[model samples]
Target: MIRDIFENAYAAGAYSLAGVVLMAISFLVLDLLTPGKLRQHLWADRNRNAGILVASNLAGIAIIVTAAIVASDGRLVEGLTYTAVYTIIGIAVMAVTFALIDVATPGRLGELMLHPEPHPAVWVQSVAHVGVSLIVAAAIL
Candidate 1:
Protein backbone atom coordinates (compact mmCIF):
# COMPACT_ATOMS: atom_id res chain seq x y z
CA MET A 1 0.00 0.00 0.00
CA ILE A 2 2.83 2.37 0.86
CA ARG A 3 4.54 1.54 -2.39
CA ASP A 4 1.34 2.13 -4.26
CA ILE A 5 1.00 5.55 -2.67
CA PHE A 6 4.55 6.43 -3.59
CA GLU A 7 3.96 5.35 -7.15
CA ASN A 8 0.87 7.50 -7.48
CA ALA A 9 2.73 10.48 -6.02
CA TYR A 10 5.54 10.00 -8.46
CA ALA A 11 3.19 9.96 -11.41
CA ALA A 12 1.45 13.11 -10.27
CA GLY A 13 4.77 14.80 -9.72
CA ALA A 14 5.87 14.11 -13.30
CA TYR A 15 2.84 15.78 -14.81
CA SER A 16 3.18 18.72 -12.45
CA LEU A 17 6.83 19.14 -13.39
CA ALA A 18 6.00 19.18 -17.07
CA GLY A 19 3.44 21.88 -16.49
CA VAL A 20 6.01 23.91 -14.55
CA VAL A 21 8.54 23.69 -17.37
CA LEU A 22 6.02 24.85 -19.91
CA MET A 23 5.00 27.75 -17.71
CA ALA A 24 8.61 28.75 -17.13
CA ILE A 25 9.34 28.77 -20.83
CA SER A 26 6.29 30.87 -21.54
CA PHE A 27 7.30 33.31 -18.79
CA LEU A 28 10.84 33.64 -20.11
CA VAL A 29 9.60 34.26 -23.64
CA LEU A 30 7.13 36.86 -22.47
CA ASP A 31 9.81 38.59 -20.44
CA LEU A 32 12.11 38.67 -23.44
CA LEU A 33 9.45 40.37 -25.55
CA THR A 34 8.34 42.99 -23.05
CA PRO A 35 9.79 46.55 -23.17
CA GLY A 36 11.77 48.48 -20.55
CA LYS A 37 9.30 50.44 -18.46
CA LEU A 38 6.88 47.58 -18.25
CA ARG A 39 9.70 45.20 -17.46
CA GLN A 40 11.04 47.39 -14.68
CA HIS A 41 7.58 47.71 -13.22
CA LEU A 42 7.07 43.97 -13.28
CA TRP A 43 10.33 42.38 -12.13
CA ALA A 44 12.97 44.90 -11.11
CA ASP A 45 14.18 43.45 -7.83
CA ARG A 46 15.15 39.89 -8.56
CA ASN A 47 16.07 39.40 -4.93
CA ARG A 48 12.61 40.25 -3.63
CA ASN A 49 10.70 38.28 -6.21
CA ALA A 50 12.86 35.16 -6.24
CA GLY A 51 11.58 33.99 -2.88
CA ILE A 52 7.99 34.47 -3.97
CA LEU A 53 8.56 32.40 -7.07
CA VAL A 54 10.12 29.65 -5.03
CA ALA A 55 7.24 29.71 -2.63
CA SER A 56 4.77 29.46 -5.45
CA ASN A 57 6.62 26.48 -6.90
CA LEU A 58 6.67 24.82 -3.50
CA ALA A 59 2.93 25.33 -3.22
CA GLY A 60 2.49 23.66 -6.60
CA ILE A 61 4.56 20.69 -5.49
CA ALA A 62 2.51 20.39 -2.34
CA ILE A 63 -0.68 20.24 -4.37
CA ILE A 64 0.73 17.48 -6.53
CA VAL A 65 1.71 15.52 -3.43
CA THR A 66 -1.79 15.85 -2.06
CA ALA A 67 -3.34 14.70 -5.29
CA ALA A 68 -1.03 11.73 -5.42
CA ILE A 69 -2.03 10.68 -1.92
CA VAL A 70 -5.67 10.94 -2.83
CA ALA A 71 -5.33 8.89 -6.01
CA SER A 72 -2.94 6.21 -4.79
CA ASP A 73 -5.32 3.45 -5.81
CA GLY A 74 -4.16 4.06 -9.40
CA ARG A 75 -7.60 4.64 -10.79
CA LEU A 76 -7.03 5.85 -14.36
CA VAL A 77 -9.93 8.27 -14.43
CA GLU A 78 -9.09 9.69 -11.02
CA GLY A 79 -5.43 10.04 -11.88
CA LEU A 80 -6.26 11.91 -15.05
CA THR A 81 -8.62 14.17 -13.19
CA TYR A 82 -5.96 14.88 -10.59
CA THR A 83 -3.41 15.69 -13.28
CA ALA A 84 -5.76 18.13 -14.97
CA VAL A 85 -6.66 19.76 -11.68
CA TYR A 86 -3.03 20.01 -10.59
CA THR A 87 -1.98 21.50 -13.93
CA ILE A 88 -4.66 24.12 -13.68
CA ILE A 89 -3.60 24.87 -10.12
CA GLY A 90 0.01 25.20 -11.19
CA ILE A 91 -0.94 27.64 -13.92
CA ALA A 92 -2.97 29.67 -11.48
CA VAL A 93 -0.06 29.78 -9.06
CA MET A 94 2.28 30.95 -11.81
CA ALA A 95 -0.15 33.68 -12.79
CA VAL A 96 -0.41 34.87 -9.22
CA THR A 97 3.35 34.82 -8.85
CA PHE A 98 3.70 36.96 -11.97
CA ALA A 99 1.07 39.36 -10.72
CA LEU A 100 2.76 39.66 -7.35
CA ILE A 101 6.11 40.38 -8.95
CA ASP A 102 4.53 42.95 -11.24
CA VAL A 103 2.86 44.69 -8.32
CA ALA A 104 5.98 44.69 -6.16
CA THR A 105 8.52 45.70 -8.78
CA PRO A 106 9.01 49.00 -10.56
CA GLY A 107 8.93 49.02 -14.36
CA ARG A 108 8.25 45.81 -16.26
CA LEU A 109 8.89 42.16 -15.28
CA GLY A 110 10.29 41.09 -18.66
CA GLU A 111 12.63 44.03 -18.99
CA LEU A 112 13.99 43.62 -15.48
CA MET A 113 14.88 39.93 -15.76
CA LEU A 114 16.31 40.43 -19.28
CA HIS A 115 18.55 43.44 -18.73
CA PRO A 116 21.71 41.35 -18.94
CA GLU A 117 21.78 41.70 -15.21
CA PRO A 118 23.14 38.71 -13.38
CA HIS A 119 20.79 37.53 -10.66
CA PRO A 120 22.16 34.32 -9.24
CA ALA A 121 19.39 34.23 -6.67
CA VAL A 122 16.69 34.35 -9.29
CA TRP A 123 18.41 31.62 -11.27
CA VAL A 124 18.78 29.53 -8.15
CA GLN A 125 15.11 29.89 -7.31
CA SER A 126 14.13 28.92 -10.84
CA VAL A 127 16.41 25.90 -10.70
CA ALA A 128 14.97 24.87 -7.37
CA HIS A 129 11.50 25.05 -8.80
CA VAL A 130 12.52 22.87 -11.71
CA GLY A 131 14.18 20.37 -9.45
CA VAL A 132 11.19 20.13 -7.17
CA SER A 133 8.91 19.66 -10.14
CA LEU A 134 11.09 16.89 -11.49
CA ILE A 135 11.09 15.09 -8.15
CA VAL A 136 7.34 15.35 -8.00
CA ALA A 137 7.05 13.98 -11.52
CA ALA A 138 9.30 11.07 -10.71
CA ALA A 139 7.17 10.22 -7.70
CA ILE A 140 4.06 10.26 -9.84
CA LEU A 141 5.48 8.24 -12.70
Candidate 2:
Protein backbone atom coordinates (compact mmCIF):
# COMPACT_ATOMS: atom_id res chain seq x y z
CA MET A 1 0.00 0.00 0.00
CA ILE A 2 2.87 2.35 0.84
CA ARG A 3 4.49 1.55 -2.48
CA ASP A 4 1.29 2.36 -4.28
CA ILE A 5 1.05 5.64 -2.43
CA PHE A 6 4.66 6.46 -3.27
CA GLU A 7 4.12 5.65 -6.94
CA ASN A 8 1.12 7.92 -7.13
CA ALA A 9 3.08 10.67 -5.42
CA TYR A 10 5.86 10.24 -7.94
CA ALA A 11 3.46 10.51 -10.80
CA ALA A 12 1.90 13.65 -9.42
CA GLY A 13 5.36 15.14 -8.97
CA ALA A 14 6.31 14.40 -12.55
CA TYR A 15 3.13 15.91 -13.89
CA SER A 16 3.49 18.97 -11.71
CA LEU A 17 7.02 19.42 -13.02
CA ALA A 18 5.66 19.27 -16.53
CA GLY A 19 3.16 21.98 -15.68
CA VAL A 20 5.94 24.21 -14.34
CA VAL A 21 7.97 23.79 -17.51
CA LEU A 22 4.93 24.66 -19.59
CA MET A 23 4.31 27.76 -17.52
CA ALA A 24 7.89 28.88 -18.11
CA ILE A 25 7.41 28.41 -21.84
CA SER A 26 4.18 30.36 -21.70
CA PHE A 27 6.04 33.20 -19.98
CA LEU A 28 8.54 33.23 -22.78
CA VAL A 29 5.73 33.37 -25.30
CA LEU A 30 4.17 36.27 -23.45
CA ASP A 31 7.52 38.08 -23.22
CA LEU A 32 8.04 37.73 -26.95
CA LEU A 33 4.63 39.18 -27.68
CA THR A 34 5.45 42.25 -25.65
CA PRO A 35 8.04 44.99 -26.25
CA GLY A 36 10.04 44.05 -23.14
CA LYS A 37 11.06 41.01 -21.17
CA LEU A 38 8.32 40.17 -18.69
CA ARG A 39 10.82 38.89 -16.16
CA GLN A 40 12.73 42.12 -16.45
CA HIS A 41 9.60 44.15 -15.95
CA LEU A 42 8.62 42.11 -12.96
CA TRP A 43 12.10 42.14 -11.44
CA ALA A 44 14.49 44.85 -12.61
CA ASP A 45 11.88 47.52 -13.24
CA ARG A 46 9.92 46.61 -10.11
CA ASN A 47 6.59 47.02 -11.85
CA ARG A 48 4.08 45.77 -9.32
CA ASN A 49 1.17 46.02 -11.70
CA ALA A 50 3.04 44.14 -14.35
CA GLY A 51 3.99 41.58 -11.77
CA ILE A 52 0.39 41.19 -10.69
CA LEU A 53 -0.83 40.73 -14.24
CA VAL A 54 1.91 38.30 -15.15
CA ALA A 55 1.39 36.32 -11.95
CA SER A 56 -2.31 36.09 -12.73
CA ASN A 57 -1.54 34.73 -16.18
CA LEU A 58 0.69 32.05 -14.65
CA ALA A 59 -2.03 31.21 -12.16
CA GLY A 60 -4.50 30.97 -14.98
CA ILE A 61 -2.40 28.34 -16.67
CA ALA A 62 -1.98 26.47 -13.39
CA ILE A 63 -5.71 26.49 -12.82
CA ILE A 64 -6.33 24.85 -16.17
CA VAL A 65 -3.67 22.24 -15.56
CA THR A 66 -4.97 21.46 -12.09
CA ALA A 67 -8.46 20.95 -13.39
CA ALA A 68 -7.14 18.71 -16.15
CA ILE A 69 -5.15 16.53 -13.79
CA VAL A 70 -8.15 16.14 -11.51
CA ALA A 71 -10.29 15.14 -14.45
CA SER A 72 -7.60 12.71 -15.59
CA ASP A 73 -7.68 10.93 -12.21
CA GLY A 74 -5.09 8.14 -12.03
CA ARG A 75 -4.07 8.30 -15.68
CA LEU A 76 -0.73 10.06 -15.39
CA VAL A 77 0.43 9.88 -18.98
CA GLU A 78 -2.94 10.91 -20.36
CA GLY A 79 -3.23 13.68 -17.81
CA LEU A 80 0.21 15.15 -18.54
CA THR A 81 -0.31 14.93 -22.28
CA TYR A 82 -3.67 16.63 -22.10
CA THR A 83 -2.34 19.34 -19.80
CA ALA A 84 0.60 20.12 -22.08
CA VAL A 85 -1.51 20.16 -25.21
CA TYR A 86 -4.21 22.35 -23.74
CA THR A 87 -1.60 24.70 -22.25
CA ILE A 88 0.05 25.22 -25.62
CA ILE A 89 -3.32 25.91 -27.15
CA GLY A 90 -4.17 28.28 -24.32
CA ILE A 91 -0.91 30.17 -24.83
CA ALA A 92 -1.61 30.56 -28.52
CA VAL A 93 -5.08 31.86 -27.84
CA MET A 94 -3.73 34.27 -25.24
CA ALA A 95 -1.14 35.70 -27.62
CA VAL A 96 -3.70 36.22 -30.33
CA THR A 97 -6.18 37.77 -27.95
CA PHE A 98 -3.46 40.10 -26.64
CA ALA A 99 -2.57 41.18 -30.15
CA LEU A 100 -6.20 41.85 -30.94
CA ILE A 101 -6.54 43.88 -27.79
CA ASP A 102 -3.52 45.94 -28.73
CA VAL A 103 -4.86 46.58 -32.21
CA ALA A 104 -8.30 47.53 -30.94
CA THR A 105 -7.04 49.89 -28.26
CA PRO A 106 -5.65 53.42 -28.33
CA GLY A 107 -2.18 52.77 -26.95
CA ARG A 108 0.48 50.13 -27.34
CA LEU A 109 0.03 47.14 -25.05
CA GLY A 110 3.76 46.89 -24.49
CA GLU A 111 3.90 50.50 -23.44
CA LEU A 112 1.13 49.86 -20.99
CA MET A 113 3.18 47.06 -19.48
CA LEU A 114 5.95 49.52 -18.81
CA HIS A 115 3.69 52.08 -17.23
CA PRO A 116 4.32 52.80 -13.55
CA GLU A 117 0.70 53.43 -12.79
CA PRO A 118 -2.02 50.84 -12.62
CA HIS A 119 -4.20 50.69 -15.72
CA PRO A 120 -7.69 49.39 -16.13
CA ALA A 121 -6.49 47.57 -19.20
CA VAL A 122 -4.36 45.29 -17.05
CA TRP A 123 -7.48 44.24 -15.16
CA VAL A 124 -9.15 43.53 -18.46
CA GLN A 125 -6.13 41.55 -19.54
CA SER A 126 -6.26 39.55 -16.31
CA VAL A 127 -9.91 38.79 -16.92
CA ALA A 128 -9.12 37.70 -20.45
CA HIS A 129 -6.50 35.29 -19.13
CA VAL A 130 -8.93 33.78 -16.64
CA GLY A 131 -11.70 33.56 -19.23
CA VAL A 132 -9.47 31.73 -21.67
CA SER A 133 -8.11 29.52 -18.89
CA LEU A 134 -11.57 28.47 -17.73
CA ILE A 135 -12.66 27.62 -21.25
CA VAL A 136 -9.52 25.57 -21.86
CA ALA A 137 -9.85 23.85 -18.48
CA ALA A 138 -13.47 22.96 -19.22
CA ALA A 139 -12.47 21.49 -22.56
CA ILE A 140 -9.78 19.36 -20.96
CA LEU A 141 -12.08 18.26 -18.18
Question: Quick one: best lDDT, which candidate?
Answer: 2
> What would the C-alpha RMSD of candidate 2 be, to one decimal place?
1.1
Model 1 lDDT on a 0 to 1 scale? 0.52
Query: Lowest-lDDT window of 10 residues in candidate 2?
Result: 30-39
Each prediction's RMSD to truth: 9.0, 1.1
Write candidate 2's Cα lDDT for 12-129 as tens digits.
7998898899899888887887676777888898987688678878988998888879887888888888888898999898888888888999989867865889888888887888
How close to the true structure is residue 125 of candidate 1, measured as C-alpha lDDT?
40
Query: What does candidate 1's lDDT look like per residue over 58-107, in tens digits?
Result: 55555564555455465655665666555454445444555566567676
| Candidate 2 ranges beyond 4 A from true positions | none
Q: How many backbone clashes does candidate 2 have?
A: 0
Off by over 4 Å in 1: 1-72, 120-141
lDDT of each: 0.52, 0.84
Whole-model alpha-carbon lDDT for candidate 2 = 0.84
Residue 111, candidate 2: Cα error in Å is 1.2
